[model samples]
Target: MFQPRQMTKLLIAASKDHIEEVIGELYKRRLFHIEDYVRNEQEEWSGYSIGTSLTQADQISSELVKIRSIINNLEINEEQLPKADYTKQSELSKKIASDLPDIAARIEAILLKRSGLEAEQKDLEQKIETLNPFLAFQHPLEILSGYETISFLAGYGKGTPVLPSESELFTSPVRRGEAFNIVAVRSGQLAECERILLDAQFQKVVIPQEKGLASAAVERYQQQITGLQSEIKAIDQEFETIKKQQQLFFVSSEELLTAEIEQAAAPLRFATTEHAFVIEGFVPTNEAVSLVTSLQKATGDKIEIQELEILDLNEEPPVEFQNSRYAQPTEALIDLYVRPKYTEIDPSLFMAILYPLMFGFILGDVAYGTILLVVSLAARGFVKGSEMGTKLIQILRNCSVSAILFGIAYSEFLGTSLPWHPIWLSRHINMGGSASHGVEYVSHVPELLILSIWVGLFHITLARILGAKNASVMEHGEHRSKLMFAHIGWILVMWGIIIAIWSYFPLLLMPDLTGLPLIAGISSSALFGGILILIGIVFIARDNVLELMELPTIISNVLSYTRLVAVGLSSVAIALVTNYIAITMIIDPALKNFTAISIILLIAGIIVFLLGHTLNTALGLLGGGLHPLRLHYVEFFTKFYRGGGKIYNPFGMIRKYTEAEK
Candidate 1:
C-alpha cells in the first residue's frame, strides 16, 4: 500500500525467424514496458542495430488512414454504433480494403457535384440582392452602361437634388425617404454634373451588363437558385443514406488497422544482428513467470528470456501505483504535484485520510454539507465513464461526509444552532442574556486553535518517519552515517518541544490548567527538551553545520496550520449574520400581521436567505478544498517525497469499441 509495485528487468533473445512470434506473445500478455536499445561500441551488444520494420509499418498505416478518412466523411457517431468483435477484425479490415474504393469514389463524385452547386447558389443569391434595389427602374441594365456619347452616372444620394430640368448636363432626379436613385446624363460639362452630385453626398452604384429589366434579371436568378438548392438537397439525402449503411464497417476497419500497425511496428524498439534479435524491457515481478511461459509456448522454445538484476544507480525503473478504490482518487491530487520515484513511498493513502479531515474541520455545517454531498453524487453519475471526473467527484463526496460528521459535533446547520441539543457544544448558547442551557462554541476557539497546531505536529512527524524509511531502503546495506542519527534526533526534538510547551505554557491557551502539576512537570520537560535539542545539533553538525539555519522554519510551518481555525471561524460568523438579517429585519416584522407590505417583505427575506447561504457555500468549497491541498503539497510533500519517475506504459490495447474473443 505504501510503495509502488516491484519490477524486474527482462531481456529476450531470439532468432530472426522467431522474433515476430516473441513480440506478439509479449504484446498479448501486456506485461512489459519496452526500453529502446542504445548502441555502444564498447559493449558486446553494440554489433546489433535497430531492426527494419518500416515496410510492414507503412502498409498497415496506409490502410489505417483510408479507413479513418472514410469514417470521418460519413460522420459516424461512435456512441450509437454497435461494438465490433476483435476476432473478426482482421477479416473486416481486409474486406473493407478490397471493397472500399468503388463505394468511396461514388460518394466523392456526388460530394464534388454538391460543392459546385453550393457555389452557384451563393453567387445567384448575391446577384438577387444587387438587383432588388434597381427593380423600380424599368430600363435595360445594358443600356445604362453602354452609352458612349452621353455620360450616364447612376448613384444614391441622401435626398433628391433640385435639378434644373432645363439644364443640358443633368436630368431625372428621383427620391424615396433619405434615399435618392438618380441618373445623370451629360452631353457636355461633365465636371459640373459630377460636382452637383458630389455636393449631395452621392455614392456610385455599378450596374451589370444584362439585356433585361432589373426585375426580370432578379426573377431569372431566383429560379436558378431554387433549382440548385433542390439538386443539393437530393445529393445530401443520398449521402446520408450511404453513411447509414457504411458507418459501422468504416469504424471497425479503422480499429483493426490501428492494432495491426502497432503489432507490426514492435520490432523497431529491438536490436537486431544479421540473424538474431535482442529486446529489453521491465515486467512486474508477479507476472514474470506467466510471461515467460506464454512466450516459450508461442515461440516453440526458440526464444530465451532472462531476468536481470538492476545494478546501475542511474537507471531508474518505471513506477506503477497499486491502490485500493478508496485511495485511488488521491492519485489525481498527488499527480498534480509530481509522481513518486520508483523507490520512494506512495503517499496516496495518507492523503486520502488527512485531506478530507482538514476540509471537514474548516467547513462544519450540516446543511451545506448535505448540499455538497448531493451535488457530488449527481456529478459522479453524470460523468461515470470519465476517470478524472469520477475521481474529482469521489474527493468531493469524501469531504462532504467529513463535513457532515463535524457539523454534528458543532451542532451547526448552515451556521446557526438547531433546537435539539448538541452532542458537544453549540455556538448560539449564552449570547447576550440568552439562557445558558449548554456549553457555547465561541468560548472554545482557543481549544480549536490548539487542536489545529497539534494536527500539524502529528502530520509532520509521520512525514519524517516515512522519509527515514525510504532513506533506509535506498541506502540498503550501507553503513549508517551521522546524518541518519541527525534525522532521528530532529524527530525527538520536535516531540520534546511540543511536550515542554504544553506543560509550561498551559495558561496561554488552556482554559482549565488547575489539574496540571505545573512546577515539577514543566521543569522536567524543559530539561529533557533542552537535552534533545543539543543532541540533535551535535549529530547534524557532523554532516553539515548549515542545517541549523532551518530550525526556525520548523516552528513557522507548524504555526501555519492555525489557518484551519481562522477560516472556520470566518465561515461561522458569515452564516450567523445572514440568519440575523433574515430573521430580525425581515421575517419578524412580516409575521406581525398579514398585509401587502408584509408579504413583500417575507418574499424578499426568503430571497436574501437563499442567496446569502448560496454564496457562503461557494466560499466554503473554495477555502476548504484549497487550504488542505496547500498543506499537503507544500508542507507535507517536502518531507518525504522526491518525485521524478516515469509512469509505466505496457504494450497492448484495452479496446473500448470492440469485444474480444472468448
Candidate 2:
C-alpha cells in the first residue's frame, strides 16, 4: 500500500500506423478521447478532415453527406445554413449517398405512375365542379306532371346588358354557342326567360322561356368526372405501396452501411508533407517502455517521444480521467457511484480502502454482513450482464467481508443481545458500563458513539494524508504542511483522551493506575498543539479572519458524521418498540382479542416504520457521501491541483448510432 507509482505523460511523433497503434492501446486502457486538433499544412483539407491524407478521410466524407441530406430536406420558413459555393453539389452528393438499388427502382415506379395519374385526376375534378351548377336547374314540365320542380337561379355576366324573363334572363351581346334554350315552360314571355346570354362583340340576344337546357350537358360531364375519380383512387393506392417499398429499401441500406463502415476504414494510409500528421493520446507508465521499443522497431528510428511532467505521486488521480486499464476491482466499483473530484485522485485506490472501512464501521452485523457478501459475490461471479452495476456490486461484496470481521468482534446480529458475545464486545463493555432492566441488562449506546468518533477520526486522517499526497504533486508546500499538522494534532488529542479515560476508570479492569492524572494532563498539551495546528493551517491557506469562520464550517462538517450513530440507534430502537407492542397485545387480559387486532393494525403501521427509517438511513449516507467530497473539492482541491489542462482527442468517425474504429 505504501509503494509509489510513477506517472509520466508522453508525446510521440511517428508514422500514421504507429500513431494509430498508440491511440488503439490508449482506447483499450479506457482513456476516452476528449478533443482533437488537426493541422493542415496546405489549404486542401475541408471541414474536420486533414486533406486526402489519413485512412479515415472517408469518415469525414460520410459526415459531409449527412450534412447535405439535412440541407436538402430543409422545410420552408426554416433557417437555411449559410450557403457555401458547393450547395447544389452538396445536395446531390447526399442524394446519391442516400440512394440504393431497390429504393431507386421503387421510387422510379411510383414517380412514373404518380405524375400522369395526378394530372388527369386534377382535370377530371375541375370538370365535375363545372357541371355541379346544373344540379340546381329545374324543368317546369316535371311540376306539371306531378313531379316537384327544383327551380334555381343561375348567374353569369361580364359587361353585358341583361333583360329579365320569368323563367330565365338573357344578357345583351350574346354569341351563337352561348345561347340559353329553355327545354319547356308553362308560358313563353319576355318576363319568363330563365337564362341571360352575354353576346360576343357587344351583340345582345334574349330568349323568353321558363326552363334551362344546360342540365343534360352537365349530367354527361358529371358521369365522365366520376369515372376519372375512381381511376385516380386506384393509381394513388399503387403510388403509396411503391413509396413504402422505397422507404424500406433506404432504411435497410442505411443499417447495413452503418454496421460495415468502421470495419472497412481501419487500414493505414499516407499523404505528402502538405498534411502534418498528429498522433496524441495517453499510455500507462508501465506500458510506455514496450510501446517505445515497438515504435523504434517498426519505423526504424524516425520517431520522436516527448514525456510531459507528471504531478502528484502521493495522491490518486480522478477515476474518470485515468488511463489505466488495470485499476483494482474495488476502484472500478466506486467509479459507478461517484465521479472523481479531480484528475489527481485515483478513484480505484480510494475505493479499495473506503469500501472495506464503510462496511466495517456502518454495517458491523455478522449475519447481515454475511448476507451482503454472499449476494455481492454471487452477482460478481454469476451475473455476466450489467457490467457497470456488476462491478460496483462486486466491490460492495468484498467490503462487506470487513463488516463480518467487525461483527464477530462485536458479537452482534441485527441488534439482538448475545450473552456469549466475543472479546470486542467485552472491550466496549469495559469502556462504558452496562444498562440494567431489573431482570436483565442490555448493550451500551454511548460507547457506540465514542467508537463512531474514533472511526471518524481514522477516516478523516486518511483523507488528509491523501490530500497531502496531492499537495506534494502539485508543488504546493503550504497545503502539505496544513494537512500534516492538522491530522497529527487531532490524532494526538484523541490519543491523550483515550489513555486518560482507560487509566482513570476503576471498573475498566486495569493494574494499579495512580498516575492517571499525569496522563490526563496531556489534555492541555493536546489543546495547545491543536491551536498550533490551526495556526499552521491558517498560515498555509493564507486565510483571513473571515475565512477563519470556516472553522465552524469544518466542525459542522465533521460533526455531521454523528448521524451514523443516530441512524443505527434509530433502526434498533424502532425494532425494539415493535417487540414491546407485540408483548402488550399478548398479555392484556381484559381486551386480549381487541389488543391483538390493534397490533394487526399496527402491522400496517410497520410500512411507515420501514419507510421512515429507510429514508433516514438514505439521508445519512447522502450527507456522508457528499460532505466528504465537498471537503476534498473545496478544502483540499483549493490547496493544490489546478485542473484546467486540455484533454487529448483525435480525428475519427463520430456517430450517434454507430461505433468507430480505433
Best by the TM-score measure: 1
- Give the alpha carbon lDDT tens digit for every residue of 367-477 in model 1: 989999999998877876778788888999999999998888788887776565565434442334432223244546666778788788888888877777766766544
Against the true structure, what is every candidate's RMSD?
Answer: 4.4, 15.1
lDDT of 2 by residue, 1-662 (tens): 22223334555555554544544433333432222335555664443243242365576446435433422322211122222222232333355456543444554565566667667767756655554433344543233223244232333435433444334432222344343232223244322344333242222222212233446655655677677667767766765565443333233334334333432332222221332444343445666687666655555666777765545432332222443443456444434344333444554555456556554555555655676677677777555545666656655666567767766766655444445555443222211232311212335556666665555555555655665565454445565555545444443434444444445553222333444334346544444445555554555344233444444444444454555555545544543343333333232331445655666566655555455445433433344334444434444334333443333332233332222332
lDDT of each: 0.76, 0.45
lDDT of 1: 0.76
TM-scores of all models? Answer: 0.85, 0.50
Which segments of candidate 2 are over 4 A away from where they belong? Answer: 1-10, 14-35, 38-275, 293-351, 370-387, 404-409, 422-440, 476-547, 581-662
Residue 648 CA displacement from its true place in model 1, Å: 0.8
